[model samples]
Target: MENEVQRPLADFPVNIWEDIFTSFSNSDLGSDKLKEKHITLKETVKESFMASRANPIENIKFIDTLCRLGVSYHFEKDITDKLEKSFDCLDFNQKIRQERCDLYTVGIVFQVFRQFGFKLSADVFNKFKDEDGKFKAHLVADARGMLTLYEAAQWSTPGEDILDEALAFSNAHLEEISSRSSPHLAIRIKNALKHPFHKGISRIETRKFISYYEAEEKCDSTLLEFAKIDFNLLQMLYRHELACVTRWLPEAPNGIPDSMKHLYRTIIDFYDKLEDELEKQGRSGCGFHLKKSLKSTSNGYMQEVNWLKKDYTAKFDEYKENAILSSAYYAIMGVTFVGMGEVAKLDAFEWLSSHPKIRTAAEIICRFTDDITSYDFEHKREHVATGIDCYMKQFCVSKELAVHGLFNIVSNAWKELNQELMRPHSFLFPFLMRILNLSRIIDVVYRYEDAYTHPEFLKEHIVSLLIENIPI
Candidate 1:
């Protein structure tokens, strides 16, 4: 202890979750009873999907609901199979089919199809526009219609001016309309306005959405119960994994700057174990991509440290080039698809290595969103110039303007990401889903602050995910 070096150190918050996971085990959870109920409810939900087939519109809406509820992973095959069958078969745009679809129906349908990669056109919303190419005034009267339209606009691809207008129009209206709407509807709208479902992480959004879904007038009690139980059961498994990890950490490698070395070895060991596991599963070349990402991320971190140590402010472009790598979403993306069987082949990762549009888009989202939320906290200590700082210096803008510019980049990236996900299926849906989810993780973790560092703010998330069981 006498040899321990004394130096300036970060005033890191105490780990609020200390000893929490270490004391817990999944074995005591009532998983068997939950599973029994889960099975029944799942079947009921599926049977409902099957029975609702006569109305593709309603069925797809339910599919989207299940997804937002975070239980869609359970019905992936069924949803896809049924969707491929008549989602295309219905082809029900009012202009073409003379259908009696309302703004809510059209908006939800457009959003659902696009989300599943259907390449649905923004032109589908043209009827809602008046001759001046503006959304009709009466359309704003219906609060649900505005909310759904706002959500659908969140899925806009590049160059979709109609959707651009819709976003502006609906966003302005939603903020104003919330006060006049019913409490339930207003709560849902405010939630959407703040964290639009299209761009939110599934687990985090699911936790928030369960409450809103439960409050719906036509809340499917069976389906809602299934989601709650499934979430709690998964929470138990997550805790068990953490408990195992906590037990293992102290035994790992150690050195001067002991924590860093320990973390480095832990990460390497993870990839090595993952590679070995993948090899056993005949996913040999996947390790190459994983290691490649790890190397790139390491270099990015090194670059950032060099900048900070030198007190060098990089140009916005230079900072961005490194920031994306430092985001580590590229590495995260590769590992995500490693377990996904044949869909993630060597060529698949090769494509990622080439800096595909979707990958870049996701990286931008991750990096900039983090910078916007954390720069103040980060500035308290010596740190590399964040993207916001870089933009400010480059453009001679205020912090607010610099943040706005970076956010515009994030928004544009989301649009580009949306376009890339359009119906043509250039890559397997599973692989693409990984990239999407990685981006989603950024949105949740870095929304208002660096919750990853100041995790006290994420207490609600921690409790909902690991501690509290949704009462039946």
Candidate 2:
């Protein structure tokens, strides 16, 4: 028990250790710590299960099963007894506990308990075991119960011997339970079950956890289901190893041939020029008349232009070779999600109603519009459309079909925005209102004053961009 009491302090400050211990109870250990604990617990749980199977142990205590679950050093019955008896001794280390708590609290915020949800406070564990006239059972059972929830939610594989051991622990005290079910625990179990391997667990047992305080009925379950599906997609992507590479690829290529390396380089240079030209346009006029430069009039420039067009075609042909399938999949998925922004805005409005935070709402609206205006979204859309257009172009439905599909996505977004405007809710209304006023002021200044065109005024304005006039 001396070692057990010092374990948290030894590895981390006292307060930090307590916070980690709280994590064990909060049940997020599965995602973060399950893999680490698996090796240690494997043999112990197997042995315990085998032992129980060999003979019907009458006491069937949780500690007996816990001994098989894994080794925590303090998990041993004798050590647990010593620690419980000596907890008061360690209680003197207040500074350590505070530090540990702060660390653990950070983890809780960045991970674990995300979003706003009620966490039930109850004794969580009840049955206690008396070994050699010492209180050892309750501590073991409490720790084991918390461990089971963490592992159950976290384990990549669902029904390992450790989980069986956990069930055995829960069953041992089935007859003498006094503490009510934890709402958080129930949510954890439901989330775990969303995975295919865990689907077979007794739904009846899970339902017993349903309580009056479950906030946002079915929302948690829906999110859990979606998260599981996305996780599996991620897992599949990882297995294929394409999840890592697609981010750095260019958004658009004007058909370049790989065989002619010189032409490919020139094409990229042209696009760089295009980017500069677009930036210039943003600062000045929306359109420009093309004037033939001396270089463009030369045969060498004409050859390069022709070569650029050919190479663009070649690059499109080689896109599959250069890009990962998962990269393409996620790119398209991102586009789809962005297209869903309008829908999300509508949902946010529905959620916030008329009392939406106009400031936040306007920011969301601005972000989507800014994406379109800056041509960031257009660049990606053009790349994807280029590829898809190539394949489908043979069909009569090619160009028109692709355009219709993109149009539909954009239309859906606008419809969502309209709905939000009609009935905004949550923080949307207030946030949108604030952003609208700010955008309007900027628009008015740009239209009325040529100050943006003046270098000194531009420098001062850019310097003061995010600064507010009043103190917060």
Task: Please list the Cα RMSD from the true structure of every candidate, rounded to 1 decimal place.
Answer: 3.1, 28.4
Tens-digit lDDT track of model 2 for 1-472: 5543221111111221122111122222124343434444444443443343321211123232222211212234443343233233444223223433332122122111110111111111111224443224553434324334333222111223332343355444422331333545445434333321112122111222222112435433322232222223323333233212232233445466544466646744653564355445342211111111112223333443454445453232343222222122212222222222333332332332222333233323332223223222234322332333432453446545644543333333332332233222334333332333333332222322332233342333322221111110
Off by over 4 Å in 1: 1-8, 95-99, 256-270, 339-348
Q: 202, model 1: CA deviation in Å?
A: 1.2
Candidate 1 residue-wise lDDT, 154-191, digit = tens: 99888999999999999989988999999988998998
How does each model score on TM-score? Answer: 0.90, 0.18
Q: How far is 15's C-alpha from truth in model 1 (Å)?
A: 1.3
In model 2, state the lDDT of residue 37.
41
Per-residue error for 223 in candidate 2, Å, reads 18
CA lDDT, every prediction? 0.83, 0.30
Off by over 4 Å in 2: 1-140, 143-323, 326-328, 340-472
